[model samples]
Target: MARVVVDVMLKSEILDPQGKAVERAADRLGYSTIASVRQGKRFELQVDGPVDDAALASIHELAESLLANTVIEDFTVRVEDN
Candidate 1:
């Protein structure tokens, strides 16, 4: 089996309300050493065959089209050896 990992994060220019809230909560909980937090999402896809360049390219397309919003978010996709 092979694994593909997709990480999605909001664009730096976009406002992240959820991240800000978590940061504030962390500060109130005595985690003030942390400067900020940017929340994001991860998607792990399991493929039945060997991971190759073609699979990586397909995963990249999937991540861009379905997993992340290109307008407001950026995504990185990587394949993990199984």
Candidate 2:
């Protein structure tokens, strides 16, 4: 089996209300060193077979299409060795 990780996040141009809220809360809690915050998602996928070029390509496509909003977000996918 192979493990794949997908990280999805909002583009820099997009405003993140949730992240800002978290940042504010953290600041109020005395974590003043935090300059900013951005929220994102991580997905772990376990493939039942070998991870090859085609599999990687497919995973990339999946991340671009389903796992992230290309118009406002960016994403990266990588295979993790077990």
Q: Point to the candidate with the largest lDDT.
A: 2
Rate residue 34 of model 2 by lDDT.
100
Taking all chains together, each candidate's TM-score versus the true structure is 0.95, 0.95
* Native RMSD of candidate 1 (Å): 0.9
* lDDT assessment of candidate 2: 0.94
Reference-based lDDT, residue 51, model 2 = 91
Best by TM-score: 2
Model 1 misplaced regions, further than 4 Å: none
- lDDT per residue as tens, model 1, 1-82: 7788899999999999999999999999999799999999999999977778888888898988999999999999887666
Worst 10 residues of 1 by lDDT: 48-57
The TM-score, computed over Cα atoms with residue i paired to residue i, of candidate 1 is 0.95
Q: Please, what are the lDDT tens digits per residue for candidate 2 over residues 1-82?
A: 8899999999999999999999999999999999999999999999878899999999999998899989999999989978
